[model samples]
Target: MADTIDEKTGTGRTEQIRDTSSSDRDFRLEEIDLNSNRDAKIKNPLAGIPHDALMRNVEDFAREREMTDLTDLLKKGAQIAQRPSEFETIEGLTDREREVLRDEVLHRWRQPKALYFTVILCSIGAAVQGWDQTGSNGANLSFPQEFGIPDTEFLDAAKTIPNPNFTHNLWLVGLINGAPYLASALLGCWISDPLNNFFGRRGVIFFSGIFCLLSVIGSGLSQNWWELFITRILLGIGMGSKASTIPIYAAENVPASIRGGLVMCWQLWTAFGIFLGFSANLAVQDVGRITWRLQLGSAFIPAIPLVIGIYYCPESPRWYMKKGMYRKAYNSYIRLRNDPVLAARDLYYVHAQLIEESHIIGKSSYLVRFVELFTIPRVRRATLASFTVMLAQQMCGINIIAFYSSSVFVQAGSSPRTALLASWGFGLVNFVFAFPAVWTIDTFGRRALLLFTFPNMAWTLLACGLCFYIPEDSKAHLGMIALFIFLFAAFYSPGEGPVPFTYSAEVFPLSHREVGMSWAVATCLFWAFVLSLTWPRMVAAMTPTGAFGFYAGLNVTALVMIFFWVPETKQRTLEELDYIFAVPTAKHMRYQANVAFPYFVQKYIVRNKNAKLEPLYQMDKNLAEGQARSASISEKP
Candidate 1:
């Protein structure tokens, strides 16, 4: 023990002789100097040294005294060096190991069954989004009869007379219906960030669920279109909140490996919800005027599950980290993961990555941050691509098809009931094909699918337009239009429908994720508003052929833009993508490709030689280190 003390004190140096063998293994000497300000050159007695350095010295002494092998010394040194700070390096974990750690952490928070149940619960919000959007489609089918409104003939006559009163009422109905979405978009921009900060993801979701419940009830009990419009506005507010927060919540909670799949569930349920709304509306179409009310009111049912189940769902560990609640974040990670050791490791890695990334992109005012989005060339390209894709999705005549399907059918010589049922069939087809999107999105990659589907959609729309040119007396022509509509919906399910959201969410950096997504959605809504407002007029002018032809033309334009611009984003992680596009060469390629494809590809492909793949390599290293640290910590006891 005397010789041990002498050696540990370093070469004949005398230090305080304290025996703490009786206490816990974690015992430490109070007088040992490990402060950062300690003199570096000091060799005097009681010279302050870092705890790490002292541990190394002690371990070295032990090795010399015991004639230990290098492996044994390293193992002993690791045990002695195990401190809070030593767990920071986790970038060395293997993919399988990281996944194991991720799973372990998730299991710690909740049972596997409960985790899956959370997915189902959160999907309610998704369903509500779908139902709300399409519910009006079916309602429009019966709205003219129920309200004693002029049918298309009377409305056309009313339009010709051009009485200011009749024109005002027409505009009023559009306002009442359109006003909510406008308000919701504005509110979404203002409320989402602050609400996320104030109420937490779960809280905001719960509050939105309450709003949905009330809106559905109010819409159900509406005495007039004006009253229903007010309810729709309220519902729109809820939808806006859902749009901003649901993806954030889902992204934050899910492990990276399964995140895309889990988030896609939101889209899946949304399609299902549309199907349900359309089917329900069809079932009650002949029942009475109240059928539309029942259809609109049924949106409330899903909110119950959201409100109840959200309470059990944990707040995002990422959000907790953002709040600097490291311990709380770790605990949440544990809940999400179900393993303390793995949770600790993941929590540290997540913290490090977030902090490092945030530091690189300096914290700035919201306006500055927004400006930065366009200032960075790569980010700009991504932003524009996102905006264009969403714009194309809305402008491609899907909404027109949805909102005026019954009217279209009437022109094609189908009764209102048959037309409404056909609309329901469209929704059902959309729902069925949505599953393929989930399976293929990650497997086949985004660019390939977009490239394939856009042309098909264009051709289908062209065929439908030609069908409209066929004489109204021909049943075969009408049959072709119906078949084409089904094909259009199916093609859309795997293409524009799910891919826009997926791409928008993927291309932005972590810091700009929420803002980018919000902007994309805002763009979608803005175009949707334009299309919705103009669609009735366009359909009336072109008599379906001109409108479908115009949309088909837009589809062709979208195909050209997508073929040159969008990159394959399937299977790649966000971090990996960030690194790939961070270089000057990649950045140039990204923008130039958007404008001129072949030249951009040639130049960028050559420059790809200079593209450094270090970030991905570093990320893999960090993950491995994290897993090893987790394993070490788990084995400590």
Candidate 2:
């Protein structure tokens, strides 16, 4: 379609075809999308222009924008963006610019102070979200009783007594505990589209933080379960909006090389906040009637820093560009990048890609763009991929543990004290294990980690449930149950924990990102709402063993969904991903099942050292590699 680049020269070339049929157009589009990465050879719309002509165009572009002072810098920047790795030959290159450019690749993690501050702000928002969740976990033990709505009472290890109004109490308690997620799914997440449209990313986060503060205060002061429910309903709005916005905000600002790790800070710090929430739960579990109040209210602490610090952070430069504030976007980029030259390169490069993106997903009414998330082919693929990851997150049953691990431990013959301790142990394991993913995610890539860990999670959860069959009289019973759950958390924290949000945030084109993310987060939180709402009743009826075993089975199903639908996005920039998502789901599925599986079986299962596994979409060091792959696949029996 637009243009193609030579891998060695980074110069554009065009090929003529007599066919103008829609099928041919579609074929060319696939070529651009599927050839996304060939050892850094990608379609560049700006390629093949002569240096003099490109510089002249840059001069005119700057003059029109009242940026003539930056004309020299802009010329060099444009040249570099066209041929990123071959900047050494670009004319008018100063030693300082050259050194900075080199440093960008060598020290990608070495970023501007403002960029890190932005990440911290986003992370704080995530912590607020995580903390809000744990408050209810600990508060659940005591709040219902205080409100004259105790759901149950245990007389012995295996025998539990339901309250006379147990059915009503169970629904109310679940409703109260699950209020935030419910509000998030139904209202808060969807509103993010409009909020982001009007208030910008920072504004949505700021307002959400304010909501979180109000809800936490109201929950602590509520005198009844219904009052607590209403208050948490308010908290859900904040949680939904904040959850939708934070990952997108973080992903937009970070470099692609380490994007997985940086964007995943949302989950890592959320786990830390979960740790803090559980810590608060432990600290106040013995405070008599006030324990639950303190647990519920302490969640407000993380929100305070989030609201205050977000103002100091720069808005996403891409957002600035979308809003047509070019000068302001460039200024934001200056503070974000380590050097002005790098800033210039990114600004122009992103702008060029955005132009191409606009052709694919044009500016339309909000409703049209929202509809495009499913109706447009490329955007629809992103929606499906994002939906798969988000749905898989819920199906993996992490939220079951997150929302009701304390209850689960209590049901397994643990005393109130032992349950809180075990919940704390799970929290600690969740937080501690998440640290390794920060490095490993970027290294191993998101898809590999998910595939490797899901089976492990499924088995561990099954083992945990089976351990419930071990007689309570056996000293090994409780200890064995805790061990398996901790192991499950270990697998979950790295794989599914960090992936869904980070993956969803970066998949959609900027035009539809707000709405696309709204859909993705809604899917996640809505399912979370269902899980939280139903689990107490489900566990009560089915018993912990059956309920846990049910979800363990779900883990395997999620793994399969992930294998076919989710694609690897490691080290690819936000715009380059346009092509990645453009790939049809059916095609991607075929590649995974028919090609990737057989190759994996040959290499890993059969231990055939000489086995050659042709990559699915990737082109190796040369052009013939991709051709050979296509020919090999076609010849496959």
Candidate lDDT scores, in order, read 0.61, 0.81
Summarize candidate 1's per-residue lDDT along 1-637 as a digit string, tens digits: 0111232332332222231122212332222111111221111111233445544544443343342333232333232223322333333434554445444433322335445666676678888877777667666655645655434542242125434354444444345445556756666544665577557778888888888888988888888777787788787777777776777677666655455566677777888888887777787788786887887788787788888889888787766655544445655766765334445445433432343245345354456656877776546656777777788787667777665666676667677788887888888888898888766776576666777788888888888878976776787866888899989988988778777776776667655666666777777766666675565555555657777888989998988777655655554445434543343434334544554454444557765554433111122333344445555654654
Best-matching candidate per lDDT: 2
Q: Model 1, which residues run further than 4 Å from truth?
A: 1-111, 144-151, 154-177, 338-342, 365-372, 376-382, 580-637
Give each model a TM-score: 0.74, 0.90
Score candidate 2 by lDDT: 0.81
C-alpha root-mean-square deviation, each candidate? 13.1, 7.7
Worst 10 residues of 1 by lDDT: 37-46
Whole-structure CA lDDT of model 1: 0.61
Candidate 2 lowest-lDDT run of ten = 16-25
For each of the candidates, give the backbone clash count: 25, 2
